[model samples]
Target: MTKAMLLLKFAGLEFSEDRGGYHKAPKGKLPFIDDEGLMVADSTSSVFT
Candidate 1:
């Protein structure tokens, strides 16, 4: 999750850390993004989106 955060930081995308939000993720994962009305899980997919 740390790595993912770093990557998103490097990409210059503004996002908030939802502490303990992993449980609500699609697959119980961290580093998910809730952009507008879309939720993207995983670093790779999030980057591309």
Candidate 2:
């Protein structure tokens, strides 16, 4: 999860840090991204989105 956050940080992108519960994840994943209502759960997909 830190790696995903680091990826966003290193890219100079602004992302929200949600200290939410793990039980609410889309696919039981730790690191996911929400962009304009679009959900990104995979690490690879997030990089391009």
Candidate 3:
């Protein structure tokens, strides 16, 4: 997942691991966000990020 996140970072986007809610992923599972506020789960969702 780190590798995937790096890719997104390279694209000049933002990724935030959601917290304080069910929408957030597990402690270990990092949910990411894009500049436009799009949320993503795994590398599978990185496309949207």
The TM-scores of all predictions, comma-separated, are 0.65, 0.73, 0.36
lDDT for each candidate structure: 0.76, 0.79, 0.56
Candidate structures ordered by TM-score, highest first: 2, 1, 3
lDDT of 3: 0.56
Kindly list the per-residue Cα lDDT of model 1 for residues 1-49, writing each as its tens digit.
Answer: 6767888788797767878766778777776777786877777887676
Error in Å for residue 29 of model 3: 3.0
Query: How does model 2 score by TM-score?
Result: 0.73
lDDT of 3 at 18: 38
Better of 2 and 3 by TM-score: 2
TM-score for model 3? 0.36
TM-score of 1: 0.65
- Per-model clash counts, in order, read 0, 0, 0
- Residues 1-49, candidate 3, lDDT per residue (tens digit)? 5776678688886656434655454334555443455444566656653
lDDT of candidate 2 over 1-49, digit per residue (tens): 5777889899898888887967656788877777777877887878776
Q: Which of candidates 1 and 2 is the stronger one according to TM-score? A: 2
